[model samples]
Target: MRQYLSADKEKELIETANTLMAKGKGLLAADESTASMLKRFQSIGIENNEENRRLYRQLLLTGSKDLANYISGVIFFHETFYQCDNNGKPFREILKDNGIIPGIKVDKGLVPLAGTNGENTTQGLDNLSERCAQYYRDGARFAKWRMCSSMSSTSYNFICCSNLSERCAQYYRDGARFAKWRCALKIGDGLPSELCIRETSNVLARYASICQQVLRKFSFFSGFRTD
Candidate 1:
């Protein structure tokens, strides 16, 4: 037995979801790590310089009025947060003036997934909730956390999923009423079976219930989990 969102509140949240999403818009994710950004630059034949990064983002931020129609938000690195357009306004301010939310990548980095070669977990649990509060105060409306889990012969997906969802629910309780958990499966070689589907749904439902309880304590809002 699981708790669910009421219909009236559900309709209200649906109407209030990201304004950008109302007109076929999506978010542009630019919050790659330094190492990841450098790798991305290597592919594009651009040097990973502060000026280059600033110019790149400034270009995107100041590109066109039409850009704002489709691109709802720009996720920035710490360096980008401090950068400004040629007119001297902070990029964060630039985005907000155009109905776009400015976001920050708060996770420190990734760490090795113990016993799983070449797989890893994000490394930012230290004081993360406090950091998120500060970012929210700085004008970030949403946040993203990427976590990886696997279903293998020995791995228990329920425990892993439950733990990850619990952490993300706390993230929302801090300040980001609108946040997303990017849960990726890394080593699932098994095919989806009836038991697997049922178990996965059960685990996810429990996770949503816990999330709703935590959120209810934090804010007087209501909605159902969509994913």
Candidate 2:
């Protein structure tokens, strides 16, 4: 309930968000962590070194001039933030010059939420304001924090909602224009019952409401996988 952004700041946030969500435009999530990127590269028989990573991202960011038409925004990892395109232009500048917004994934990773049967929460809230301010100064207009929960029929709704609301408000105050939360559900013959579905929905709704209270655009990504 603590409001830290000025009226102008709030308006700026809203306008940026609206522009990213403009007609026929969507976000491109290119913020895979190093480990995740390694796995992806390995699957395609490519080495996952720094140069290769940089090249891959450069290709994605500068592959076509028409990308901005459909890719309104791009969420980048920390490494990509400082990378330059083939033309020596910073990736952030390249995106901005093409009328695309640049964002960063701010979560450190997932950590176990104590006293639960494998429930986890996203880390990286420490010094969040400082980090967000720096990212904003570096040409980032938005940020993402991913909070994940296991589909083990546990009552994690309370913890998930409270953590998301608190962190969403904090991130908004620190200059993030929008945020994304991912909740995953495992599907099986006798899994993902009514209880799990209802709990996930309730948690997402609560998080969305809290995000609105802080004047930030909220996006929910639900993953259905069978393990």
Candidate 3:
């Protein structure tokens, strides 16, 4: 079989993950979609406009340099990734300056899966490989795609792993190319069904395997949640 990840590459991935997930520091998930952002702004009585969005993220990225001490990394939505500070400095640079890692949320908002009750799956798979390559070139070293476990089955493992890992290996040859898959499990009446668990676990296992083969890295997970 072809060697997808060399031993050296594997070591690098492990070390990077360990450093990012150190004892106290945490990764911030600011990957909410624009629609989701709007809902949040409404909750707080603020208008959800382009400037407001940029300003909000600007505050997060332009905070005290001491932010690195508590936040190991911050995951930004695509717009936030490219958004600039008042002086035209990109937010990616701000994170780098503060010794914080920059990551991006690449998934388009969730869409309903037809023929299923309240089931949904994430979009953004179209040209995903190309987009990820471009994101890595621009500055993002890691990316995330979240899925609602109850919405889809575990069938895209092979395709996703192969597609993402193949290009990610070349793009982030030396640094990090974390392929983060955020899986959310729900707990409602007769929820978290066995099917959901199996589907999520199976897909995650595939992702993990490819990380071993081609990545040796990804948004290395550190915690789990159920709701």
- List TM-score per model, in order: 0.65, 0.71, 0.73
Candidate 3 TM-score, C-alpha based = 0.73
Candidate 3's residue-wise lDDT over 67-163, tens digit each? 8889876788887888899999998888877877788776676676544456555666555556666776788766666665452343333223323
Clashes of each: 0, 0, 3
After superposition, the stretches of candidate 1 with alpha carbons farther than 4 Å from their true spots are 1-16, 116-118, 149-177, 188-227
lDDT of 1 by residue, 1-227 (tens): 44354566445434434342456777688776667778878999999988788888888778787878888756677677778998889888888898886766665665655544344556665566566666666666555555544446454444334334223332232223444454445234453334434543554344334434433221122233433
- Local distance difference test scores for all models: 0.56, 0.65, 0.61
Q: What order do candidates take by TM-score, descending?
A: 3, 2, 1
**Model 3, stretches more than 4 Å misplaced?**
1-3, 150-176, 187-227
RMSD of each: 7.2, 7.9, 7.8
Which residue pairs show collisions in model 2? none
Which window of ten consecutive residues has the lowest lDDT sum in model 3? 166-175
* Strongest candidate by lDDT: 2
The 10-residue segment of model 2 with minimum total lDDT is 218-227
Candidate numbers, best lDDT first, in rank order: 2, 3, 1
Candidate 1, overall lDDT? 0.56
The local lDDT score (0 to 100) that residue 168 gets in candidate 1 is: 38
Model 1 pairs whose backbones collide? none
Clash pairs, model 3 backbone: 178-218, 179-218, 211-216
